[model samples]
Target chain A: MNTERLTEPSKDELASGLRRLGAMDPGPDFAARVMGRIGTAAPLPAPKRRMARVIGWLMEPRTIRVSPLGSLAAAACLLLALGLFLKINPGAESGRTPAGLSPVTFVLAAPSAREVAVIGSFNGWKAAGWTMRNDPATGLWTLTTALPPGSHEYVFLVDGTTPVTDAAAALNVDDGFGSRNSVLLVKNGDGTAL
Target chain B: MDKPDNDRDDAMAVERTLSGEREAFAVLVRRYQGPVYRLMLRFSRDEHEACEMAQDAFVRAYERLASYDQRRRFFTWLYTLALNLARDRARRVAREPLYRQDLDMTLADPGRDPLASLEAARLLDALRDLSPKYAEALALRYIEDMPLDAVAETLGVSMSGAKMRVHRALHMLRELYGKEGKQ
Candidate 1:
């Protein structure tokens, strides 16, 4: 057997030799050729229509949905229906009131000289027949109107148009856009009056 | 080795390509095509097959550029893909006895002195006689002048493993040369 020590080649000798053996210069126009092929190759088709179809299917009814706007609209309609029912049916138990029945009563207090009336969500907030005469001796104005034992709001009319709130009213609600309304929550059949 | 300067350059080129300069991608294709093609040739053992595999690897790399973890070595990833394709080709070759006659010296150098070309061819033939893994290790080590670690990365193995493969290949080559001397 031939026995000889193997010696390592210098870096320069190794590099130039490998270069000559085709380790470098991949070929002329290699990059341009590759990029040209890539550019000219047919592109993958997009799935926009398929995606839109999927979205449409998902958005269809009977699928899961959390519609805040629809829920809000339903809530508003429910509230409107409730308000209408409450207006038409003030006292749920009794509908007939004697012309002079006067069993239902409404009042508003004005310490100064003025006139008062019962006006509410029930009677469209008018003060026609239910006006109170001011007693000059006591300087207090009081009105009593036969309301059908349900919730209503009333206030004092200082000459004709100026409406004053009743300080002693048991119920008051803020009118939200920055005004105040006196609310009277009257539960009928409990023998309560306001 | 050079503080990943070439890799940084590759990433910049990739970025430029994605930013609508398709020409930038060509620069990358040009730069790495040699290594990638050589690696594929070692695997396929045929120029045409190697060229096809290399092209496939590059196209695949371009398509999946977005998924490439730029923090890692790009060639390693590309070579892995090319090697896998070559392995598939090898498996197919093993299954089917489809062989082409080895390129003759006459064809390799039609005009050059036949004796010198024959010596270079002899060295290549000796290298090819080694097991595929060992031959690849030797080729990448001496022929390509790649670092042991980079060769391992390309071959998808550990450094010590690649080092051992190269060491074993050299021992085999010496033994073969010794045998030739005795004859």
Candidate 2:
């Protein structure tokens, strides 16, 4: 593929220059600006969806990790994961909350909108009993309710008919109606909120 | 993202952010501004566009934090999300013009990158000529210093696929550099 041989920069040199791009920095106020958009002392918590501390325990480069540990250790890790999953996610497949409902909180930060409601698979996509409570001081709308441990899809219905996507959702799926709905997994945890 | 020791700290910060700690989320933003900003630069027409796109990516990631698979690294997830936003931006904004222009512009405007070596500049110029996917593969592999597995995970490709892309990318970059010999 070489029409003319070039020896200015070898592969290693080219690779080195490319890697230097990784060190480019942004403006000093970058973080503050981001916070300004999210708010510093707002009235409500960031959003309803959050914190998989256990999940973030694994970082990017760790994907290639291979330990010389025996298969027994692997099995133990698997068993621990399964136990943790079952413990953290009781309402996973059953879609029922026999161990009692988990408190699931959802927040929508819509200041301009006059009304907001949450409609999802749990409520059959209806907002009848899911009208959200708004705080004028912060203009953040919040809704905390108990749901059986399981997966759920929802959206914030701003005003009355316009559906808005939850930017804070753990997962968002196609709504099949030219829009997207946020997804959340409610685990069978303690008195803590999901 | 590569720092194993930071994993626990990242987890803690992420947990705080998820728990509605806005300030905690700022820690992540401040921490990752460098690589994230650099990543967005490839997809933008200029630094301003890159900055806007990078910020948008973070806000979107914050919005979709719940959707993130915990098994993956936060930076990986954030990088993937930023790439998606860049793609979406490409469709809507219709930008990412020729890379040679960027080279010329940066050289002419010494304030932009006064320290850029000619060799380094030419290499970057050729890189931008490759297709987005190929460039992305090379960037992830060499620039980001990601393992093949991490590159595969970021690109959503199998390990073999990642290897193939990298191979092809290097060949293509070599051809482009050869053409530069005429200049």
Candidate 3:
């Protein structure tokens, strides 16, 4: 531990310095000023609507809090998480998606590619009909598919040859090979845009 | 992540918060707001910006509550968020670096009303002259009387790093005091 040598200032000197530093007062109504901002700040209008607010509130990080109920919820969540983690194949395994359904669109900017397939937790990482075609004139590859509504990790197999990742998505999971696969977490029964 | 009783308390709080118990969060805000505000004030030169950043940090923390690791102290996480926001604000304003300073009067005027106590005002001014990092370290370590490990966690630095910051800050403070004494 890098403890500082507490300089032995004369008592009078130290007391005077301490008194000087201690005078800066907390602003009156400091707490009120802080609390006033609770729900008033106008978020991006488009994302401030009722549904978005609800989704954001539910998925919001601060809601988890550091309180008694929060701890219980956290414990339950941890247990649930542990259960889910343990139930899943813990070993080196092929991509096996859980049972559910979520609609996802895979986009690739490979104008030069003839094909692109998605392989991830959704379809056992298989290269099949998941390959998408470029709208040759537009130079962008696009494929929309129904994935189970949950956290599904996926990536594009460009030209059925090169595996490419999504740049625009928010969540991503590492794909063991020093690369990452884009993750789309579709909340259960919510068609909200991430 | 302390004892079972504490864990129970945390869990109960978590449940209330998740159940949309607004006051539960308020309880948390009231509890940790002072530390968070002070930390921000150390980072941002102005009280208004510090208040704004601290508020933003709380809002952001509230939004990210579900991801809160229950084992950790809420204040530590909130401090990290507040510090990050202050850093972001600093970057946007193209402010001086954290540990480097021009020793300007950027701090003498914290707001309209000056501190009522003369001695405290001098100390506050001296503190303000230090770099944000050093000032924050000193405030957290000395003013707040936080333990070394807690200070480290709040500052998001290793224990050794936190100690170094505090050490350097105090050394500078002593120097500033020496200059004042000479004067």
Instruction: Name the best candidate (by DockQ).
Output: 2
lDDT per residue for candidate 3 within A1-194, as digits (tens), equals: 12322423443454455533433334556556555666543222222558878998788777434888889998999999877876563321323334465445577787777777778887888987677756888888766666666677888887667877788878778878899988887776543435
Chain B TM-score for the candidates in order: 0.75, 0.80, 0.71
* TM-scores, each model vs. reference: 0.49, 0.53, 0.45
TM-score of chain B of 2: 0.80
Residue-wise C-alpha lDDT for candidate 1, range A38-135, written one tens digit per residue = 87543232335678889988888895565999889989999999888866665433455545333444444456645666565766777777677566
lDDT of 3 by residue, B1-183 (tens): 444554466556655776667556666676666677766666665556667777788777766676676677666666767778877877787544322132233234455344333334445556767888887887777776677887898777999999999888787877775565455
Interface Cα RMSD, each model: 5.7, 3.9, 5.8
Query: Clashes in model 1: which pairs?
Result: A104-A146
Each candidate's DockQ score against the native complex?
Answer: 0.14, 0.20, 0.09
Q: Higher TM-score: candidate 2 or 3? A: 2
lDDT of 2: 0.75
Q: lDDT rank, highest first?
A: 2, 3, 1
Candidate 3 is scored at a TM of: 0.45
Error of 2 at B60 (Å): 1.2
Report lDDT (Cα) of residue B10, candidate 1.
Answer: 81
